[model samples]
Target chain A: MKILVCVSKTPDTTSKVAFTDGNTKFDEAGVQWIINPYDEWYSLVRAIELKEKDASVVIHMVTVGGADTEPIIRKALALGGDEAIRVNSDSTDSYYIAAQIAEIAKQGGYDLIFTGKETLDYNGSSIGGMVAELTDAPYISLATKFDLEGTTATVTREIEGGEEVAEVALPAVVSCQKGMAEQRIPNMRGIMAARTKPLKVTEPVAADALTAIVNFELPPAKAGVKLVDAENVEELVRLLHEEAKAI
Target chain B: MSVLVFIDHADGHVKKSSLEALTYGAKVAAQLGTSAEGLLLGTVTEDLAALGKYGVTKIHQAANEALNNLDTQVYAAAIAEAVTASGATVIIFSHTPTGKAVAARVSAKLKAGLVTGACALPDTSNGFVVKKGVFSGKAFANVSINTAVKIISLNPNSYMTVAGEGTAAVAPLAISAGAAKVKVTAVNKVSGDVPLTEADIVVSGGRGLKGPENWGILLDLAKVLGAATACSRPVGDAHWRPHHEHVGQTGVQVAPNLYIAVGISGAIQHLAGVNRSKIIVVINKDPEAPFFKAADYGIVGDAFEVLPKLTEAIKKMKASA
Candidate 1:
């Protein structure tokens, strides 16, 4: 079995969002880049789980980013991916990114494709579905748990009010969410082996750019707190009614 | 051309988000020089025609025993058929779970361009462009759908539900519904009045509340406000609250009109899930807690001492009003 996993380079969770070059684009300066938490934890772990279940299964990881993103890609390799592919494209638009990943999946003929339910940065969650369509493969998003026995895979996912159990045949795409697996940290041996792991760099496939970001601005900072003094219970009630108006 | 909006429900009752979608679709159809129609699947106990007051001119339904249960494959096929047969140029669905699954499938089947998690009406000026969240809730992306038929899945709580005096003409579309291959033998419903994700107002507490027994104060405030109850990720993990009540990066992502965070330090993970909220009220004793930096309103007081008093005031206001 051949599986392909999609990863994205996003700002570390703690980075303060800012823009550069006169605020026209997101300022990448001094920002620590990491595998999008969702894709790293859920999608990568589930892919490793599949490889563990079957010895012949080969797990491959790929990302669409600039040359600088190679380190994050290597970290994913250290986490257990057998091989890696990097499409040298730094485009942030979902359609352009999807086009690049879709071209790779089409060329590779992967039996299964895995991506996080959505990336922390481009919360679109639309790419995997689009890639599935581009590949003419069935798509299942937000699977919490999955098992493969034969040609078909049964996936259990959480919905708005309840859970759903679905089954689809092979040669499909599935997006992973929280309950798929816990986040994995690469150890020393895996990191050393990742240095020699097959990391392939390829030119991006030409595709139509569907959308682009016009500008990015930080969310407005909030004001200071209105402390009512913990001991003054009456003052707190007065504040709630007069100031908050929510009560 | 007509725009069809799917009304999602649980146990035969329409959800608030569905109504918001109806309002959004109606406005979109009017903008596109078309009629706004609605499609009600599953069994709903509410009068369908009355819902038309929100802007729908007609409500087409397929209320079957099997339809009452959510089967994405069956739903996708049914809605796709409806769109094709009804001559629907634009089909809208709330980005809720059922709608998410069905929208993608129907778009693929109908060969339509789908833009999910749309925060507002399409930019219908030069062409059809939908603004959607790109980096989770961090940034916005405008996607242009240059297709004849367009599919849009609106994000929950983004569009306000506008009500006007419009009575809907009810019609049951005669279409064959597919069978659900997956069967649900039983559903163990979570014991809670307000679903954490769907609530317009969410009242969540963290370790600041002290312990599980002290949760009543939080619950009382939430109940008085008609708000859903949630907890910080740590509190939920600590078993102070049920897992379903967890709201943060690893838990549910919500964009309610109002989010009330009590005792939480406003961790980045928690803020990512709820930063899109229209208004935020943070009540934490620590004046320097990170949550204060994002709150529209911040109250510094011991929750045990403040929350109960706030609940009592709300109860009094509700009773007098």
Candidate 2:
């Protein structure tokens, strides 16, 4: 089985979200970027697990970013991918990125493609489904468990109320969330092997996105906490009615 | 000119998010100097004409069983055909799983510019710019779309749902339908009173609830308040609850009117899913918990002790009312 995973570099979840240029763009000036958490935990880990079972399983890592994201791509390779491909252009929007990935996967003849359900930064879970549509592949979002036998892949997706198990065929795309696998850390040997692996950079095919970012801003600050006296139960009830209106 | 809104339904009832999307679409339609019409893909039990209260003037219902389950290709094709038939220049959808998929496919089909997860109305002074949540609800980004036909998927709970006296007229849509490539074998639904994603009130617990054995306090509170129950990532990871009830950066993202966190430390990952709640209440024995700072109300007490009293008080109030 050939599995392709799309990883994106986003700011670590703890970073203070701020914008520069009069709040026109995200201030990437002094922030650390890590692999999108969902992509790392679900998409990448499951791909590695499949590679272990089928030695013929080739795990291909792809990213849409400039040269700065190479280190993250290399780290993914160290985590256990056979090869890496970097689209040598900064993706301006989710559609452009999805187009680039779909184009590549179409040319490569991938049996399965996986992506994190949503990016932590953009919060756009559109890439996987968009790619699936672009390539005319079946898509299953938020998969927790994925298994393959013959050409059928049984996937379990965590929904709002419960789990949904699906049976899909080959040449499918999946957007993965948690409960996919036990987290894995790169070992010394895997890290050393990654150094010797080939990292290819290819020019992006010409495709213009129809949308563009107008500006970026942070949400309003949360109000200071209000502590009501525990003894004043009536006050709490009244506040729940008048102030919070949560009752 | 007219705006088209996709109406999402599940198990015969229309979803709350779709109503909000309808309201959003209607508001956008007004802003664009156009009328708004709705397109229903699947079967629904609710009165279609009553939906006019949300500002839509007409409804195009395609009562096909093939649409009971979501198939983006079929939905996109159907919506595009409806748009063409209705002479719609703008399209709207909710930022749910089905909406995201169908909107993109429709955008490609119509060559329209799309803005997903829009939180506010567009600024049409110069061009069409829509504001949306970025950085997992930590920040906002304004995207400008310059296209002949535009597409937008509104975020849940961002726009207030408004109703008017106008009731829409229903019109049955007659279009050639195709068989869906995928089929739903069985639906292994998670058993709960309220769907977690669309719940108005949510009560979530974390590791501080101690263990799965002591989750009664959380459930008791949720039951009394008629709220959906959720857990932090650690609790779900521990198998105390199913992974589907997990709400965090890597889990389900919800925007309830009220989110009450019990024994939760409020990690950034967890907050990403729920920061959109209008009001937040954090109850914990430790006063130094991180959630208190973001909470509108904070209570420093043990969950075992506080939760029971809270549930009792709410039940008494409901009975009195």
Candidate 3:
């Protein structure tokens, strides 16, 4: 089985968010980049687990970014991906990114495709469905559990207020979320091997972005907290009802 | 040249987020000087005509039983067809699980610019620009949709649901749902009066609660306040709470009117999921807990001592009111 796992580089969760160049570009200075937690902890780890179970299974990691994303892709390789493909483009538009990934998936002809439910940066949970549409493949989003037997895959995905168990044949796209797999750390030997693994860079296919970023604005800062004495629980309740009007 | 809103429903009732989307779509239609319409794929028991009070002039339904359960591909195809037939240049969705699954496919099919997590209406003054939360609500981005056809999925609780007096004309939309490739076998639903995403008030516990056995105190507080229960990532990871109740960067993000954090040291990830709340109250024994910075109110006290008193006080306040 050949599985293609989509990964992306995002600012570490703890990094302070800021924009530069008139808010048209993210200020990357002093920002620590890492593999998106959803991609690293869930989607890629699940693929590694599948590869560990089946000796013939090959896991390939694909990412769309500029040269700065190489380090993150190498980290994914250390986590058990056999090969890596980098599309040389830094477009943040969801459609443009999905189109590029779809192009790779079409060429790879993989039996299964995996992506995080959404990237940490954009929070646009749209890529997996767009890739599925572009490739004419079955799609499932927010998958919490996945199992494979023969050619069929059973997935448990989160719905509105519940979970739904569904089945689809191979050659499908599934976007994974938490509970799909546990986090894995790369060992010294794996890290050494990842340095020598094949990292193929490919130019992006010509695709027009449907959307563009006009500018970014910071969220309004909160006013200082009103410290209420724990002994005066009634005051807190009263404040909620009167001052905040939250209850 | 109309604004079409996708009305998402479950168990025959329209979802609250969809109602907000309908109102938003109506306002957007007014901005564009066009009419607002609603498109429903599944069979529903609600009075469709009464939804006009949300500003929709008409409700177009396909009325297919297969559409009841969410099939992303089938729904996308049906919606694309509806958009083409109705000549709707603007499409609106609620950004719920159903909308998340279907909207992107529809956008891809129609070659439209799709914006998810939209927090405000589009600015049509110069060009079509929509403001949305990025970096998990840490910041906002104004996105320009250059495509002729545009799709916007409104984040829950971001827009107000305004209902006036009017009845919409219910019309039958001729659209055939395609065969579903993904077959659903079973469903497991969380049994609760209020779903966390739709809750007006959310009471969340964290690792400081210590164990799952000690969850009763938190539950008591939620019960009195008529709020939904949530937990931090650590609490969910430790199995103190179900994964569905976990609210964080990777977990379910909620923007309720009020969020009360109990025992949780607010991590940046935890804040990402909840910073959108209208008001936040943090209760922790550690005065240095980071959540206090983002909270509207703070109480430096242990959960064991503070929660029961708060619950009792709220109960008494409610009884008196």
Candidate 4:
């Protein structure tokens, strides 16, 4: 089974988020990048577990970004991906990125595709569905559990207030989240093996970015907290009702 | 050129988020000098005409049972057909799970620009620019859509639902919902009065609560406030609470009106999920807890000592009101 796992680089969760260039671009000056947690901790790890069960499974990691994204992709390779494909583009538009991945999926003819539920930077949960639509495959989002049997895949996904179990034929797209797999760290052996893994870079296919970033603005800073004494519980309630109007 | 809003429903009732979407769509239509209409794919028990009070002028119904269970591909196809037939230049969704599942698919099929988790109406004064939360609500981005056909999925609770006096004309839409590729086998619903995503107020607990045995106080507080109960990652990880109750960057992200955290330290991951909330109150025994930095109200006191009193006070306040 050939599985294509789409990965993206995002600022580390602890990094202070800021914008640059008249707020049209995210400031990368002091930002530390990591493989998006959902992609690394869930989607890619689950594929590795599936590979552990079947020796025939080959996991290929694909990322859409510039060269700065290589280290993150290489880390994913150390985690267990057999090969890596980088679409040389830095477009942040969801459609542009999905179109790039869809092109790679079409050429690879993989049986399964995996992506994180959404990227940490943009929080746009649109790529998996767009790729599924572009490739004419069934797409499942917010998958918490996934199991494969022969050519059929069973997925447990989160809905509004509950979970739903669904089954789809092979060659489907699954956007994974927590509960799908546990986080795994790359060992020295895996890290060394990743150094020898084939890293392929391809130019991005011609695709129009449907949307453009106009500007970014940070959320207003919080007014200093109102410290309520432990004895004055009623005052807190009064403040919530009268001052904050939250209750 | 018209605006078509997708009315998401379950068990024959329209969702609260969809109402917000309807109002948002109506306002966008008004901005563009066109009428706003609604499309309901499944059978609903609610009066379709009454939804016009949310500002829709017409309601299109596709009363199909298959459409009720959220098949993304089928729903996208049905919505695409509705868009084409209605000559809608813009589409609106609620940014709920159902909307997240299908909005991008329709955008892909129709080659329209799509923006999810939009926090405001489009700034049509210049071009079709939509403002949305980026970096998990740490910041906002104004995105411009260049496509002629545009889709916006409004984040729940972001827009107020304005109701006026009017009734919509319900029309039966003719379209095939197509075969569902993914077959749902079972649905396990979490029984709760308020789903965390739609709850106006949320009361959450953390590791400082000691264990699951002490959850009663938190539940009592939630019950009094009519709020949903959630948990920090550590609590969910320890299975003291179900994983569904976990709210963080990796878990469920909620933007409730009021979020009260008991014992949580307000880690960045946890804050990412809930920083969008209108108001935040942090209760922690440790005065140095990081959650106090982000909180609008903070009480440095033991949960065991503070919770019962706060719950009783809120309960009394509610009873008297």
Candidate 1: clashing pairs of residues: A121-B135, A122-B134, A122-B135, A123-B134, A123-B135, A123-B136
Question: What overall lDDT goes with each candidate model?
Answer: 0.79, 0.84, 0.92, 0.94
Per-residue CA lDDT of candidate 4, range A1-247, in tens?
9999999999998999888889888899899999999999999999999999998999999999999999998898999979999999989999999999999999999999999999999999999999999999999999999999998999999988889999999899999999999999999999999999999999999999999989999999999899999999999999999999999
What tens-digit string does per-residue lDDT give for candidate 3 at B61-105? 999888887777888889988998889999999888888888998
Q: Model 2, B181: alpha-carbon shift in Å?
A: 2.4
- Over the stretch B285-313, how does candidate 4's per-residue lDDT look in tens digits? 99999999999998999999999999999
The structural similarity of chain B in model 2 to the true chain B, as TM-score, is: 0.96
DockQ of each: 0.34, 0.62, 0.83, 0.86
Question: What tens digits encode model 1's per-residue C-alpha lDDT throughout A130-162?
Answer: 677677676777777878887678887776655
i-RMS of candidate 4: 0.8
Better candidate by lDDT, 2 or 3: 3
**Alpha-carbon runs more than 4 Å astray in model 3:** none
Give the true-structure RMSD of model 1: 3.2
What TM value does chain B of candidate 3 have? 0.98
In candidate 2, what are the lDDT values of residues B1-321, reduced to their tens digit?
A: 799899988778888889998998898889988899999997988899999999999999988877877766677778878988999988999887677657876776676888888988888788889898888888889998878888899887788789887889888887675766555566777665688877889999999999999988899989988899999999998999877788888778888888999999998889988998888988888888988888888788888877887787777777887
The DockQ assigned to candidate 3 is 0.83
> In terms of TM-score, which candidate is stronger, 1 or 2?
2
lDDT of 4: 0.94
